[model samples]
Target: MRIIGIDPGTGILGFGVIDAKQGGYRLVTAGVIKTPAHTPLDERLAEIFDGLTEIIAETKPEVMSIEKLFFARNVTTAISVAHARGVAMLTGHKAGLVISEYTPLQIKQTLTGYGKADKKQIQEMVRLNLGLSQVPKPDDCADALAAAITHAATTRLGVV
Candidate 1:
C-alpha cells in the first residue's frame, strides 16, 4: 500500500509518501510546500490546494493520513492551520484516496512505542524505521513521515 501523510500549515504544508509491503516500509518522497509569508491568505491556500493536487496526481497514493488539528494558545494560528488541513483533506477526497486522521500522540506512540516521546526521539525512530541516514528536515516534514509510518503500522495491525 502507498500512503501520503500530511502536516498542514499555511506557510509550510509538509508531506511524505511511503510504500508498505512485506512488513517493511519504503520512503517514496518527503518535502514541504512552502508559501511566502508575504503572500495573501487566499493565495497561500490556493497554492496549498494546487500543490497538494499535483502531489496526489504524481504519487497516486492509496491512502492519505493527516495530523488532526489541535488547538494551541493561539486561536488565529489554529484556525489558519485548520483551513489548510481542510484543503488537504479535500484534495485527498477528490483523488479517491482513503483519508485518515491521527493525533500527534498517536503518531509518537505508533512510531516510537511511547506516546510522550519528544520530537527528536520520534524523528530518530522514523529515520531508523526507514533505514535513512538522517532524519528528514524542517521538523514538519519528519512529522509528516511519522504520521505515514504510524498509519502503516496501525493498519498492518488492523487498528485502522
Candidate 2:
C-alpha cells in the first residue's frame, strides 16, 4: 500500500510518502510545505489545503498516517496547528484516502520501542528502517517518515 504521513503545522507541514508492504518499504517522497512566518492564518491554511491536495493527487496514497495533536502550553500555537491539522485531514478525506492518526508517543514507541525516545534516536531508527544512508534532512521531514513507518509497523502487527 502507498501511505502518506503528515506532520501538520501552520508554518511548516511535513509530508512523507512510502510504498509499504508486508516484507519491506521504500520512500516515495519526503518534504515540507512551508508557509511564510508572518502570513495570515487563513492564507496559511489555504496554502496547506492546496499543498496537501496537490500532494495527494500526485502521490496517489491509499492511506494517510497523520500525527495527532498533543496539547501544548502555547495556546495560540496549538490552535493554529489544530486548524492546519483539520485542513490536512479534510484534504485526505476529499481525496478518498483512509486517514489514520497516531499520537507522538505511539509513533515514538513504534519506531524506537520507547515512548520517550529523543528526536535523534527516532531519526536514527527511521534511517535504519528505510535503509537510508543518512537520516532524512530536517527534523520535521524525518518525523513525517516516522509517522509513515509507525503505520507500516502497526499494520504489520495486524493492528489498525
Candidate 3:
C-alpha cells in the first residue's frame, strides 16, 4: 500500500510518501510546500490546495495520514494551520483517497513506543523504521514521515 502523510501548516506544509508491503516500508518521496509569509491568506491557501492536489495526483496514494490540529496556545496561528489542514484534507478527499488523522501524541507513541518522546527520538525512530542513513531533514518533513509510519504500524496491528 502507498500512503501519503501530511503535516499541515499555513507557511510550510510537509508531506511524505511511503510504500508499505508485507515485509517492510520504503520511502517513496518526502518534501515540503512552502508559502511566502508576506502572501495573502487566501493565496497561501490556494497554493496549499494546488500543491497538495498535484502531489496526490503524482503519488496516487491509496490513503493519506494527516496530523490532527493540536494547539494549546496561539489561536491565531492555530486558525491558519486549521485552514491549511482543511485544504489538505479536501485535496485528499477529492482524489478519492482514504484519509486518517492522528494527533502528535499518537504519532510519537506509535513511532517510538512512547507518547511523550522528544523530537529527536521520533526522528530517530522514523529513520530506523525506514532504513534511512540519516534522519529526514527539516522537522516538518520528519514529522510527516512519522505520521505515515504511525498509520502503517497501526494498520498492521488492526488498530486503525
lDDT of 3 by residue, 1-160 (tens): 9999999999999999999998989999999999999999999999999998888888899999999999998999999999999999999999999999999999988987889899999999999999999999888999999999989999999998
- lDDT per residue for candidate 1 within 24-52, as digits (tens), equals 99999999999999888989999999999
lDDT tens readout by residue for model 2, 12-95 = 999999999877889999999999998889999999999999999999999999999998688888898999999999999999
Worst 10 residues of 2 by lDDT: 71-80
Rank the candidate models, highest lDDT first.
Answer: 3, 2, 1
Scored by CA lDDT, what does every candidate get? 0.93, 0.93, 0.94
Q: What is the TM-score of each candidate against the true structure?
A: 0.97, 0.97, 0.98
- RMSD of candidates 1 onward, in order: 0.8, 0.8, 0.7
Name the regions of candidate 3 deviating beyond 4 angstroms.
none
* Cα shift from native, residue 68, model 1 (Å): 0.5
TM-score of 3: 0.98
Q: List candidate 2 segments past 4 Å from native.
A: none
The predicted structure with the larger TM-score, 2 or 3, is: 3
